[model samples]
Target chain A: MSDGLSILLSDVDVGPRRHPFLRVDHLQAAAGECVGIIGPNGAGKTTLLKLCCGLIRPNRGTVLLDDRPVGGWRGWRGWQGRRIGYIPQQTEYNSHLPFSLRDVVAMGRNALKPALRPLDGADFEAVDHWIAEMGLHDRRHQTFRSLSGGQQQKALIARAMVAAPRLVVLDEPAANLDTRSRWQLRDIMERLFRDRAMTVLLVSHDVEFLPGACERLLLLRRGRIETDGPRDEVLASPSAADVLAEI
Target chain B: MMDAYFIPILIAGAFAGLSIGLLSVFIVGMRMPFIGSCISHAAMVGAVYASLFQVNPTLGALVLSILAAAGVAFIHPHRRHFDANTGQAILLAFMMGLVFLAVALEEGSRTEMLGLLWGSILFADWGTVVVTGGLAVLLVAFVIAFEKELKAVLFSRSLAAVTSAATEPVYLAFLCFCGLILAVNLKAVGGLLIFSLLVCPAAAAYQVCRGYRSVLLAATGFGAMATTLGFLGSYVFNLPTGACTVIVGTLIFGACSLVRRALAISE
Candidate 1:
């Protein structure tokens, strides 16, 4: 755990009923660190990410952002939307809904007050910036459901980023993406990491796509971190490989 | 003469058709037809209670319906296992109260309570036309103004929240509105038949359309058609117009189902 870190998990235990899915004794990602969480399929990486965003609460221990305990604030949803942007592994759109790409991206701004205060020129400029940044400027008006898997993923990322949160968490952002799209996503994420002051916490089973720019690595096995250190050290560890085998 | 009373009755029937028809689309899309039916039946009890107490039946029904709607909405998100059972219990309590009050009232008490128990389009008047018209217009306007928000919430509650939309207040207002409309229209359709009006057309529309906007429009059309056709049938065959209206609605639903199947098989 780095002293300058903005996020910390202290003995966070999440489980189903009597079985603990994952346990985080102590883990931290420094301010503006591009952290990657890699582990076996059932190692609870997703659960850990969810806990950080306050989407799910741990049975014990505390999750802290910038050293402030997440649940310590009573209004967690408001806090989450404002500071943390989360992109889930998979999104299932209700076929009945008709939402455009712009609509989807705009959802990232849910934390903003809705008292007849319309999105003005500055907001439109921000939306356009994200649209072009993700290379979805032309597809902004298309219905989200009509897009391909890779395109949808890009749009989802754009949606999350448009909120301009301090921390962005993405779970397997390249899972179903084509080779070319995956590379493009990696490049986009790298650019965002380098240019924007956005701290990224990415969880991926695919080792090939872990961005070269990642600042730290945490590998989980059976709900506990197997290796936690600088990216190369953790990725090269035997225990981390064992965690990968199970993933 | 048919000219004197028939026109007003026909107009009332049309109003009934439009209000329930439009609302049913929301019910079907949200998968809450049973909830709607339960509210309608509970509202009937409120109407009877109002009539028995010598107060405005509309006011009584509104209060009761709002309370019932709130109870269900609050419990629905928190307690799925007990929601249906609890709703049934509420319906039963209100029904029993209505029946008991009816029995205890004076034999000659001239509130014409039975009229509400089994409503008639034949009883439709200028007042019924006005109230139903106002409600129908409001329902259509609200649905259009908040279409995206409505679809978001109806499709998936968590998904809706994840989106930029502020879904809590909209969801609350939706439940309350459902109860309010059911209470208001109880005077036209009665408690028993209200469920049919609220569900049949929308269910039929779901069979025909994948697009939500189309589904709502189709459901509204189905409802209006049923009311008009039902009124004509009742007039010609001398059957109860309300019952006939429900019968027509069911037939329309059946026809739509058959058409959907035929299209599927051909494709």
Candidate 2:
């Protein structure tokens, strides 16, 4: 409702046959807020994330980013890539690709730069900083597919944050991570939210991986929001308990 | 010893090999190797139709192959409803049938038509050499100019789009490049065998290399080597040039696989 919200989805409908696979009447995330969206399988969580990232357009209604309609922005991809970092689900990665972890992370900067130009000193510095921040300095030169699941996740997170975007969107970031890696990811998310004041929209199936910095919770079921409120209140609600039970 | 006549043939063969080899890295990386075969067959249909109509077969092949690429690109937007491989397969069968019909309907010497099916690189003219060489240069420039975007798309189109690269246009351009390369190489490698040249060298390089840049360099080297050796073998044994080239490429891939296995065991 507020004009200053970072992301706003209003009366959105998406999917085949106009079937309304994801119908969110209204959702708003203010700047620097961390929101966690949790739901069971086939609940449109990933689709919502894709829509937010401009990877998919809503079949109907409007998605506004930084108070601007996403569909109206000329060269929106350039805008989105520079300002809105997106970490897609691990399943979206192709293991057969020949990119090393450093190469993968460097793509964050490459996305913003012109196609023909090589990475400059600033780009290299940013890539190195994130690689070290993610504790992947030792594995930076290794092929991405050769890394363990947790290591790969860390690399992906580093890639998403390397550009230092104002907003970051992650889809199931902790899906296959080990407990220690999940905790590390939690710390990273907290640091991004608290230190940098980066707005984050995180989608997850497991509530256990939700970072402590998440101030808002959204529970989706069968393409509709089942609960949306303050994180602690939603977690204490019976509806949230039922949703987690079904998962 | 290579003579004046063999000079044009060798140059054409090498250039065609390099162009197709560079494009093959993208085709193989995107996991659409079958689409290459389909595009070559579409070129065959165009070549045969041109022979029947008395038009320039190379130009005709370029048009048809581009059309086929466009068809594939068009069908991609509806990928959930229609699989791209299925569309390519359909296009391949349709083109094969059309090629046969065109050949059957032709009143002139069908040797030319047959030549398109099984290339005669040894008989290549200087013009063919020049065109193929030009294409080879253009392809290298293209790779250099769009290396980052190409790598992102090859890794994953969806992820590439999310990262803000315009994947659809890049994908369509890639498909068009594949078609154009197939069309130009029709004289040197033949429609039936060009796809093997496109796939084998890149596949061999993929087995041996861990980085994309290395893969591109290794595939180009393998391709040029296979093509030159195949041309020499064809001259020595009086074998089909196109078939010999494909055989050599496949053998290289096999050798690379063996080397990879040996290295893995040693590690």
Candidate 3:
């Protein structure tokens, strides 16, 4: 309770079967920390991230952000906004609607305002600042769908950052980018980590793609944490070789 | 006598178009054109059945439409396996069966029921104008209120629910609002015309428009124009207003397709 910018999960288990899809006995990410979650496909890496973000609730235990439950079905005016910014992987955003990059990013401010009020000038200012920071000012007027994979990721980053969250959760942010785009994203993450005070939980398959800030790495296997420790120490462990090879 | 019918019908047309046009943007943007057809058909079943029971058809239609709109959500155990369209399809077939059964069971003259089937601009009155107009205003207010929430949820409900508490409520409210609009417009536009109005105008606008606001305005304008054209075509040529409205909407979509092609625009 009253932990500054932290996420804590206790006895979290997902699914109804004897073997839950995801199970976490206890996990906590402290303030200003970058934790990389790496695992093979279907290892429930994404599920764990969802539980942490409060997107999906567990059948067994609790996930708390700071002192409050994640979202917890809190009202729009509650502590939902300005708290956690989540960029989902495989977003269903490939529609024909004409949302410009700026328009898409501005949604990050939704939690800050009530349902009836529109985004004010300061909101747009923040949206613009993040878009510019991502080096996407030229493409701000373009449709988000038209952007390349890398550009979309950058736009998503801008979207998440616009909220000025205390905690940010990104799932496979650089999953399908080109090598150059991947490196650019790594640099961007490094810069963001250096600049912002927010805690970040990143999920990715490639260890090289995990930003320099991921001093901690969580190696998940079969829906559970196989190894959790320092980035190099976890990778150096003998058990990590088999799981990391699956990547 | 002519003035009394003409004024209210015109008002209803405008407001109905405004409301349905705005809602079209939401459904079309989210690739759920089935919602309009499903609700309209569901309303038809309620209207016909209510007429048999000596109840207000609009009230019955509204209730049923909301039920149909929420039909897919009830399959909790199988929600993961059943997408929205699958749920809609199942409910739609059931509603169709009820519509036929209601017609078969009715004994007397089916004047009100028949009016709901093909529409009766002749039956247009002041009550129709008030309901449609109120719905149009509510829809506008809703859009203003939930712009960000809509953007987030429309893109991905799963994604938005992650961070926003308003996601599920906003989405459920949208589905219910759409039902109410369809129910109110059921008598005036009928199922077929209203379905076309829901899909064609917004789909056409997307062909030529490049932004959310522009598409919304364009869809609203096209919808209003289609309704006015329907009125004029019926008045001048003595055609059925509902059929005329459908033709105009279809033509607008066809013409927009051409315009987009002429301008070499991509999806």
DockQ of 1: 0.17
lDDT per residue, candidate 1, B1-267, as tens digits?
467768877877787787788888767666556668667766777777777777898788888877777766655332242545456566656665765576467366544566666676766788878877887888888777666566656654544544433555566677788788888777767777878988899888877765567778888889888888998998899987779889999999999999999898220
Against the true two-chain complex, what DockQ does each candidate achieve? 0.17, 0.47, 0.45
DockQ of 3: 0.45
Off by over 4 Å in 1: A1-17, A20-31, A57-73, A76-84, A89-92, A113-133, A137-141, A176-180, A220-227, B1-156, B163-165, B186-267
Q: List the pairs of residues colliding in candidate 2.
A: none
Q: Candidate 1: lDDT of B39? A: 72
TM-score of chain B of each: 0.88, 0.95, 0.93
Q: Write the per-residue lDDT of candidate 3 for residues A1-247, one digit (tens) a residue.
A: 3212777888888876588888899998888888999999989988887777665667878777765676454522446444677877864454346788898888887767767788999999999999999999998999987889999889988877777777888899887889999999999998987677788899998998998788999999989899999999999999899998887
The CA lDDT at A27 in model 3 is: 93
Query: For each candidate, what TM-score against the reference?
Result: 0.71, 0.91, 0.90
All models: lDDT? Answer: 0.73, 0.82, 0.80
With a 3 Å backbone cut-off (N, CA, C), the pairs that clash in candidate 3 are none
- TM-score ranking of the models: 2, 3, 1
- Output DockQ, candidate 2: 0.47
